[model samples]
Target: MKEKKWLRTVLSFASECRMKMILSVICAMISVAGGIVPYIGVYQVIILFLDGKPMTNGIVFRASILFWAFICLAGYITKLVFYAISTMLAHFSAYSILENMRNRMADRLMKAPLGTVLDQPVGKLKSVIVDRVETIELPLAHLIPEGISNLLLPIGVFAYLMFIDWRMALAAVVTVPVSAVMMAFGMRTFNKKYAEYMESSNYVNSVIVEYVEGIEVIKAFNQSTTSYEKFQKAIASFKDYTLHWFRSTWKLMNFNGAVLPSTLLGTMPMGMVLYINGSLSVAELTMCLILSLGIVAPLTSFTVFVNDVKAIEYAVKDADDFLNLKELENQSEQITLHRFDIEFDNVSFSYDADKADSPNYKENSALCDVNLKLSQGTFAALVGPSGSGKSTVARLIARFWDVGRGKIKIGGVNIKKLPLAQLADMVSFVTQDNFLFNCSLMENIRLGNPKASDEEVIKAAKAACCDEFIRNLDNGYNTTAGEAGGKLSGGEKQRIAIARAILKNAPIVILDEATAFTDPENEDKLQKSIASLTKGKTLLVIAHRLSTIKNADRIIVMEKGRIAKTGTHKELLKGCSLYKDMWEAHIGAKQWAAGSEKGAVKQYA
Candidate 1:
């Protein structure tokens, strides 16, 4: 029943290339038939000798021998031709199936919820897509063609042996039951061991990726030894688990290996006894030896594929788990709104819902019944310390995650009812840690608007103050960003991201510390670019630097996921104590920076 299930899974994956697989199977069957013909010819020659025919006709006897030799040669050549054709077809089908599976997985991931996608680690996803999926190729390509031929050829040979002498056929299979017992014992804990091995492998992959990504942090914090300890431990654990698994199966596997191929061990002795007792003929015993040898080779080959079957089962399960993730719910019908005003109506949320035991989990909420509205064309700035839910509010408005309670409306319609594409077109969000793909600078910006012309992209770049540095680069806008825009500075990457948002030209914009990386020298120029880009649009800006948002129409002060105060900068300074303390701190930081610069300049002089 378990073997049937494995076969069913294999067939399901092959459904797309079923015709090719069937053709391959047919060719394999032909190859198996041809492969057995040579042995059959050898049996015929032995039978002729034992018949006690007169040898005075020596010419006829030699002619008969040459005829059998030609038959054997033709059979072998046919086997070779069909085997080659079958393998080629199987490989083509396997690669096609892999391509289709990968494309479907990628499409499903795009539609899945952002939170669900983010919850998965990069290494885990890479393992499933690259490593796990590749494992399926071996079973699909070789197992179908070679495995089928191996199984059927042995059955055919066994039937021929039965025809020669039924007792000898039964005797030949005496070692099979004993070998099967050894194989069963070896496989008893195979599933458990494989699961542990997969877990250990995933852990090693995760730790290696994390270590490489955090190498700079490790150096800066003087934690090289400590960070490497975790990496070493993970790798050591994987090696130990792998070695333990192999050791546990070693004895049984060796026993099965030694016993399975020794089919003639019982056959030769049993046939000799039967012949001595005058129950078996010499010709029949000779035929039994040749047929028994043929049977063992195919049976051994079949058993080897049992391990490949288990690997495919596990890999398919992992791929299915990832492909089955839930996607976000949104209406298919697009709805055009009357205005771009945003409203948070009694909103509450928690990032910890998926992480019950996390140290950062909060029972209170990330946003507790927050109520606020931004009128169309108004500039709203959110100011608060870390963990105050400022970023959460921005993400909620952009629908990166659904609110835990209450509805967030855009133009008086629940955001959930809006088509995802339409809602995406309505807002532009520029996050602090923006990602840039490994491509030319122009191509990266074109991601925001694939249809935009080069001139339009250059214009947006100029608006975001990215044109100057981009032009100064060796290839101007054509310069590659490298991986994650590693070729550019933090401030430069931030500008490129802003240029993308500007090109989007949405009516509503959310900036979550978008200008935090900019130097003081470029701050004024970036603010001007932002004002130009956001003209006549509703803008929500989250900033820790209070001086940056002083000209806002309204300043919202958040504390512990709740709104503490909402007013203009001057109004908050006089009436809101929290806002006043934050402003004082901001002023002190600016003065300290000015003093440090003066000291550095005097020291240099």
Candidate 2:
């Protein structure tokens, strides 16, 4: 994952497009050869003019001049053609790799433990999907091909130089190694700084996204100073990092820019003095001078390519980390459900053990040795205190995370044996924070089933009580939801989420406080819709308000990652101490709400 890996990886990609790559190399050679020969042609014309007689006969001199002219003309034309092909190859390869990468990353996210994604900040995940992957284009497409072409030019020039005069060639060769050593030293510093720079950019992006998303909350709290301070901090950090990088990079550039070309510059005067002192002939001097200039393009190109190769190496290292991440092992099998019933058998899990460096958390079990069975076509409620693992139970039922011990079975089949897509089709969940795309309402709703008909979408909307609000809007179903549906009320967005779940028609539905945001007026309709949808389907509801689960077929009360009690509402109220206490507290709140001047308490269940 260090710098320099990029060139090796990119070369692998180029190797796949072997023919185009070979053609590019050939074009580079032809272009360099033509450019170098012009000086020799000029030198020959000068000798003829000075001596007032040609070295060869008139026809032969004319033919030689024509031959050089043809070399220059053909070289220029071939260079353009080869460069075009090289660019196209790079473009095609980059775009192809990017396209596949995006698709694979999306698939990985889909299969990733849902709780893992929930735990991460939305802005950070957004940065990964949109910014991090997009940044790879530059090094992959432009740097790889151009870098190789530049490398070849230098090697070609050196070979031609050695052929003409080894002593002067040795002078040029010796200077390159020295310049390379200096460039390498500079690169070491630049690489570390560049890594820091990229990290700062990602942080700034995350902060900016958070600021924009929470603008309303900031304004409502009258926290403009706090918000501005955050923005100022992020921007200042980014600026400092960028400035440091530029300053360091400028020094590196100065060294590389000066040292490479200075090799030929220093060699030129010495070669000319040798010719004048009769140690070399005029033709030989002409060849040396001409070839030295020829070496300039390739030699300078080699230096630039060195830097580019290092950059690409770092990029490849990053990409390899992404590619090396382990996907679910048994992901390809088709999903099979013998029955919709779900069972958790002595399952135990702890998040800390798996992480490389456990963050701030005491050794608390997320789930203990819990056993439960959820029969098909029944409405079951999981009631618990905040850390009682009710959400963990729901997540396990959906196979969001594999159990640390024992097994989770859908019907009689282990969830691990099921195909991911098939498992997805069998279950639907509407979480507390409903996510919506920045797209038209219709499009967002259609995510439940991309090929769903407009009629089906309208039907689903009606089922979730979303049709009225949607119709009242000026754009109707065409209205944009804004980012994550920020433009809509929480209730409106939740109903849309429910509508999506309904449209999906999965056999099992998990609601993580689905009605928490709904007002009383909409609550009745939504509750009835949910009840109707649960008919002959497995339903698991997580609730804070006891009233919401009063009518559920069964309720399980959980405490400290273990089940406290399980029974009907009346049974729990009579037999379970914790349940009775929770119910009493809830009843007290309801009475207090009835007595209050503000009217009915806005209870969230």
Which model scores highest in lDDT? 1
Error of 2 at 362 (Å): 12
Off by over 4 Å in 1: 1-15, 45-70, 221-234, 273-284, 354-362, 594-605
Q: With candidate 2 superimposed using the best TM-score fit, by how many Å does residue 336's alpha carbon deviate from the native?
A: 4.2
- Cα lDDT for residue 230, model 1? 96
Question: Residue 493: error of model 1 in Å?
Answer: 1.1
Q: What is the lDDT of candidate 1?
A: 0.83
- Supply every candidate's count of residue pairs whose N, Cα or C atoms clash at under 3 angstroms: 0, 4
lDDT per residue, candidate 2, 118-162, as tens digits? 676766555555565566666666654566556666666667667
Measured on C-alpha atoms, candidate 2 has an lDDT of 0.72
lDDT per residue (tens digit) for residues 480-563 in model 1: 999999999877898888889889999998888877777767665566567656877898989887777887888899999999
Deviation of model 1 at 383, angstroms: 1.4
Worst 10 residues of 2 by lDDT: 596-605
> If scored against the real structure, what TM-score would every candidate get?
0.88, 0.85
